[model samples]
Target chain A: MKKSLEGRVAIVTGGGGGIGGEVSKWLAKEGAAVVVNDVGSDLSGGGFSSTPADGIVSEIIGSGGDAVANYDSVAQPDGAKRIVNAAMSMFGRLDIVCHAAGIVRDRMVFNMLEEEWDDVINVHLYGALNIVAEAVPIMKSQSYGRIILFSSVSALGNLGQCNYSAAKGGQIGIVQGLADELKVDNITINAVFPGADTRMTEGMSSTARAYIEQWGVSAESSDAQGIRSSVRNAPKVAYLCTEAAANITGQVIGVFGPPMTVYSQRVLMRKLYKSNAWQFDDLDFAIGSSLNRNIPESRLGGKYEQR
Target chain B: MGDRFRGKVALVTGEDHDLIKEISTLFASEGAAIVANCSHSEWVERMVSEINAVDGVAKVGHFDLTSMADAESLLNFTVDSFGKVDVFVSGIEIRDGGSVLDSVPEKWDEIIRPVMKNVFATTKYVSAHMRTQNSGQIVNIIRDKKIHHDISVTNSIITEAIIGFTRTTALDMEKYGVGCNAVISDHARNAALVSAYICSNLVTPGISSIFRVDEQEVSLYSVPAIERGIYSSDIFSVDELNYLVPKYLFDGEELS
Candidate 1:
């Protein structure tokens, strides 16, 4: 029996550890020649080591999968091009590019340093652009490609993660806006909000941990040995890179747990219709009484719920 | 002059010449001391002169919002010029548009650097002041002109970032009696009016919502939420998911 991706070639950025590593291994196991690219940067995207990429490549090859290691940072355009070039040089073709590279510098919006903001944006948002900029042209020329950006649930907005949320949120915009242009060329791009416990989550503050707990879904790290492991997210991510997923483009999918989640794009929830411009008193009354009925009154303002 | 903002001070920042002019003049007319900011000083100086000519107290801030020192200085100038800043309106216009495939790393820097640096730095400094003062209104207005057939990948990306920043900032500053919200106007139509309303006392604090302003109507954007889900005893195969996802999740119909 021929494997689904027997002749395919894949480039998995940040494939050294965690969810990205698992996805690289899964793709290789399914018969795709893999280029496992990792800068081996720390959680905040500083420092680099070739050991992480080399180790993952060895693991894949030992498991009877064809693989090579590429230690190029995706934060720069030149680095991104070299990553794509590695696939073409060794494997001769590129079919799948999964960008799971990311970093974090969590801070309250007020106290966030300029460097902190720049570093996070450079890694997550600019890194995505660098990879996609190089890979898309190749994919477009070949008339076949599958690209997946590892977005986060934080894109919706998380406390103390303004930079991260903004970067992740921008990824959503890329997938949404680019879906139309890429689909015609047979290249599909989507964002996966992988919910996994990893090094990223291990450093969660007590407040952040409590917030996650309040949501009733405890995150399990990809390295954990269990059915609830973050490794479970790998299969879904890998599946998106398969030829079978050609129909899916410009979609935001979440891989967290018992159920995979599908999110909708920005849509109008409610409206205040008017022919003439809104007067303060009238607009205030309409929004307060009707639009804000469901919102719980906060310490700042809004109508308190009548118990 | 109207007494709506008789004793208040407002700072306005953006690249759109007309929108900034309209907003600055409107706030000044409402009796608020104005700080009109831009990268270039000449136009802003002229706007400030016109406001002062009309007996409206106004100042010009030509510093870069992307710089921390400049951001702090801008805020300091506002305090030193007027007593303090009570309202902030950010009308930064996003002009980048192209397909993701056609975009480059430099384009990303060009488009994102200004928006992120300006918005984040300005909000950081301004919110620090507002937090101490125990009262302020911060409204970020994003303007984009959607070109038909252009993918607008960078534009959409920056827009979402701003929106997300607004919500996160709102949470951080809410307890301090500071309100943060975002207004997304595709055409810059009626942005000044809507922004003024957001700064008004009628708007409730701790309410961080995105409003899409158009020529005539204003619509509230729903927070992006999971509209559907597919649960299986185990993760389904590509074949199973390829069939079930659309039927159950994307079709806008209930699953059995």
Candidate 2:
């Protein structure tokens, strides 16, 4: 295939390893000047180091691709601005942004602390906005940009991940609103919900792991078999960051081993009985009818299984 | 001759009698197994039987755009018959004619209930199977203009809603390789239904001027029997729609 992103400038947050590292490499290999921004924090979104980011930057430079490392946390507005500035200062312009920096605080709603929610939201949702606000003005000046935000299947409402879900869900809303505002400016914004073997989900509860394993799936750490699956699911993130997706905006696509499904949050089938005035009995009937209409053997319920 | 979708199952809906029939027959000729054909009227049944008689695989299914249950069943029947749904085409028109004040609530619902709502229902359900298989294409036939000059404001609103829904779903499902796009057709074929209230009446002098008709004298000097004006055809050809639909879906690539 032709180099889809030749001469493009990309900024990938959390570019040390996992999805961010792979995305950073892919963009560089496709001829992009990639700015690898990572604070080297763990999956919970804390800590800092230049090792991981710098290592990836060296790897790209060694391979004759343009890249630089920036140790900046995406959680703060100033940190986000500095990352964008690094991209412009190093590459001269920014054309693509893959906001893959995020953290997971796995706690059920009852046990979820306020700090847990705030931290997750700060790094994923607000961090996304901070970066976008700084990047969009430059993109608007150029009149060409592609933004790939990371959402999760968890946003479909995962258990023991209320904070993560809230942050990821908020990312979807932000993408939709921003896409509408930027459509006339020739900028397209989209999100990818990837299913791959990453450091984040490696420690799933035995019960959940068992269920996934029973489906003939193993943890992505399982030798070559697991690595192959991870690679297959990873390219989609790169594809979304390419120029061919110009007409596509405000979308959330799921990327698994081989299957890629377009998930939709749609209005359920509604039932309205003919009436100008309503009563308790009418309310009961309407609720019952709405439930029945909504709950058929449809994909909405299938794609999102309730725990 | 090159049947990329050969041995695959395809489903089509709506009421472009000539266009749907032709497209369905073409897919069958290209080796696709026509799983189910649905329409809002009985006339579609007659067309289905004609395709079946020619040994082009097909089954008739009830489809009323107003009913989501029927829309769901249309998809279920396709999976039940062929065990998979490889392609889906929606070619229905559900908009009623009238200006803002003249258009009633019931009429607005009549138009939107099928075209917009039904398409949403189908995309939501059919995509479930495609996602599992990691492959599928959905083509929705939309009009070039949201309002056809004479229709009410509701038409534009409904059209916008569907387009928004399509864009959102397209992004969400890219990982599964499922593609979604709408084909925008021109206005000639459906003009009679929208002429009076939407477009100015094709006859009245100033009203004719609104549609850019030239001035003509009606007097004793005029001939007793004279042709008034020419009628324009706004309906797009099947070839044009087919080409455009895939272009939108694959981002200008011929490959599905």
Candidate 3:
């Protein structure tokens, strides 16, 4: 593959470990000046350090690639500006922003405290906004940029993740909204739902993890090509932060274990209408005879316990 | 409709054919004391009279749900009569009919406000009531087919926004023995009947989805032509509505 992003200045907000770390390394190997950012957050959004980010920066530099470590948090506006500044000050330009910064605070929605919701949304959704806001003006001035936001299948109203789901769902709106606003400026923004295991995901969705553990399976059960196959998609994720992907914008791509698919957003399935505004009683009866009475049995909601 | 809801109280909106004659009547037949609420329409008195004739308990009311005062009044009426609203089936209004760019502020406000604010106000007041008993279901009825005929841009936005709203509210109310979900009416009629029962019978751990009432389910009941769905496309005609209403609702019922 070509070093398509060569000479491009890029920032990977959670570049310290797992998905973000690999993405940062790949971007650097492809010849971009990488700013590997991480606040070294423990899984629950507490406890931070600069070591993880520094370590990734070291790996990139050691491999003869240009890189630097940024320890600022992306969850705050000022922290986001500082992260962007790290790229311009170090590499003299800003081009790619791979927003991989996130935190996990899983609980049944009812069990979640206010702070839990705030912390998770702050990192995943608001953090995405802060960095994009700091970068968009510069990207517009230079007339070129690529933005990639994180989303997941859980965004379809998964249990025990109301805060995470809502924030991720909101990201879809931002990707669509920003893609339109920046289309004329040659800046492309898209959301990627990566289906891979990382440090942060190690203990989440415990029921599934317990099942996998029972089978003695982990993220790298069958490593090959001198790197974990599950993480091989890091290169594909890096590709979105390159000029080669300029035409792909305002879309949600599902990057599963191997085969990737583009998702259709908010499609209309069917319709029942009237020439005049609907009256309350007439609508109820019409809905029963039409919309409700028509659909097949198994395709409806609440098939299994929603919680 | 089943006797499972015989002693329950159901508050349904829309006074026309589907919301009243079908969904609401179906509920009353099964024993739910009905609160057939509607905006002042010429057809409401007749709808209520038919319900009373069948020995089904029902009370009719006129309130523009967009206004908080009106929504509260409607809720108050239900409380005064039935002692509590076990199920609140909300019917949305759709007015804007133009391209997104052509839609002015008033048009957007007019079309979107009533649909969403009704949800906010009704759920707010009803949720307070359900909290006292620690049990209830909020079924938001959305117009799935309205824009299918005329590229109703504003309606599309409002509907999609409500889905987002429903998911968040589901999260908020699940703790209080209250479950929130939505049903997509292929049209405005029979809108509340099926969904109201679906909402009233929503078991613990409700399925959160947009149930599109298909042609097959419509054929099971003897609804008029206007009460059935027609379209620019038959994309989901083959797909079942179980993703919203669940399979139990259609058990032993014809899907053809």
Candidate 4:
């Protein structure tokens, strides 16, 4: 097979963490010169250091792949702009933008703090907006690009992930809305609901980890097997980055462990189409008699019957 | 009579099901050694007795799929007895079924944890062994969506994970000549039979999918066994298997 991305230049945000780090390496291996961007902040989005990005860059270079390190927070316009600028200045061209950087602040909806919510929003959603916004102009000028945003399964509404879910879900909307706008420009954008056993999961308590770990699969094993391990989610990201995936865009792909699921845009199911306006009694009768038989209950609504 | 899986060794989980037992019996009847894995000794004894009567090679492995310890024990017992596991059949059945309402935090863990452990532990050890040989096939059985009602969120999650793992494992093991895939069906017999073909030399992993086809008997197989030089089937077929087997294994003899 051809080196699908040979001679391309790519930028991967949060290139220091688990999924992002692997993606950086995989893209570089595909012959793309990478700008490994990581503002090493702890889970709550605190301290920033250059080491995360720097370490990945060095590994790439050591492995005979070209890479440059960018230590910029995606939360700030200046930082986002510089990161994009570095991609062009250092590599002389840019083709892929992978945004996998973010932090988590978990709490119940009622008990969640304003700042906590704001902090997560800034990093996950706004940060994605800032970084991708900056990359858009550069990609447009080139007429060829791939942008992969990091969404989460929480977008489907996890119990204590309102802030994270909101931000990630918005990322999906961004992918959907911008997809058509960029299609004429020959650019493809998509979202990934990634599951990797990376350090980012340090937030989970030991008891929870122990419970989950019984069946938990790490990205490292996936990478090592050269298969779709949770972390091997990187390879799919790399495949999307390549020209081989020219027709795929405005889509959502999920990676947890063994499976890579292509999620459909929501469609109406078991609808009761009406010829004209109906009385409340007619609607109620239809709903009970034909429309809602054994329909799935809402996850958020927390309703369950024997079915 | 044809020995389709001669000299092969198959390790099958889910000993409680009669379908899986018959599947094991078919593999053994075709001359491959069988490892019948179960959680209870009584089921194992019942399974082994029938195999013994047929002059078929078989062994009883009683271990929990949930524990990492037990997973290791299962792998070790299989390897220690059979020398290696060429095909892994994840036919596990957990009857703790319910809907999303049962998808509570505590309940979610209760349901997903054991299945998760079963998948990972098996993959970790068995894939490691297969990687050394650079050749193997893994088949997982999931409930088919055609009859997918009354399903719990817990089983739904488990099925999704198995699928992801299977696809990725297929990708991971491709270079090493190892293939992994899964089948989705309500009837264990159909699933177990399709998996038997997959584990046998007749079927190899070229296309990965959650197989949802009917598993009719050989007499009921309506599709022509051979079509043109392509060899196709509306349902699974041993003839279609020829296309997927490793090229070197054929020694340049074209099946067509």
**Candidate 4 residue-wise lDDT, B26-106, digit = tens:** 678777788888777887778878897878889988888766678778888999998998888877454454532223334
The DockQ-derived docking category for candidate 3 is incorrect
Candidates' C-alpha lDDT: 0.79, 0.58, 0.64, 0.63
- Which is superior by lDDT, 1 or 3? 1
**For each of the candidates, what fraction of the native contacts does it recover?**
0.65, 0.00, 0.04, 0.00
Model 1 alpha-carbon miss at residue A2, Å: 2.6
Say which prediction, candidate 2 or candidate 3, comes out ahead on TM-score. Answer: 3
Tens digits of lDDT, candidate 2, A185-228: 88888777755667787755432343233224454345454432
Per-residue CA lDDT of candidate 3, range B116-192, in tens? Answer: 55665666677778877888887777655432233354555455445555655565566677887766666544444
TM per candidate, chain B: 0.90, 0.64, 0.76, 0.76
Candidate 3's residue-wise lDDT over A1-307, tens digit each? 4467777999999888878887898888878999999999897889999999999999999999999999999988789999999999989889999998888887654345556766876788668767887888888889999998877645545456666766676566567645656778999988876645666566556323322232233443563322323354466566667675666687676543433345555443345655555444444566555554534321232222111
Off by over 4 Å in 1: A205-216, A219-228, A295-307, B145-151, B187-189, B202-206, B233-240, B252-256
* Interface RMSD score of candidate 3: 13.9
What fraction of the true interface contacts does model 2 reproduce? 0.00
Question: Per-prediction RMSD in angstroms?
Answer: 3.8, 22.3, 12.0, 21.0
Rank order (by lDDT, best first): 1, 3, 4, 2
TM-scores, in order shown? Answer: 0.91, 0.53, 0.63, 0.51
Supply the DockQ value of model 2.
0.01
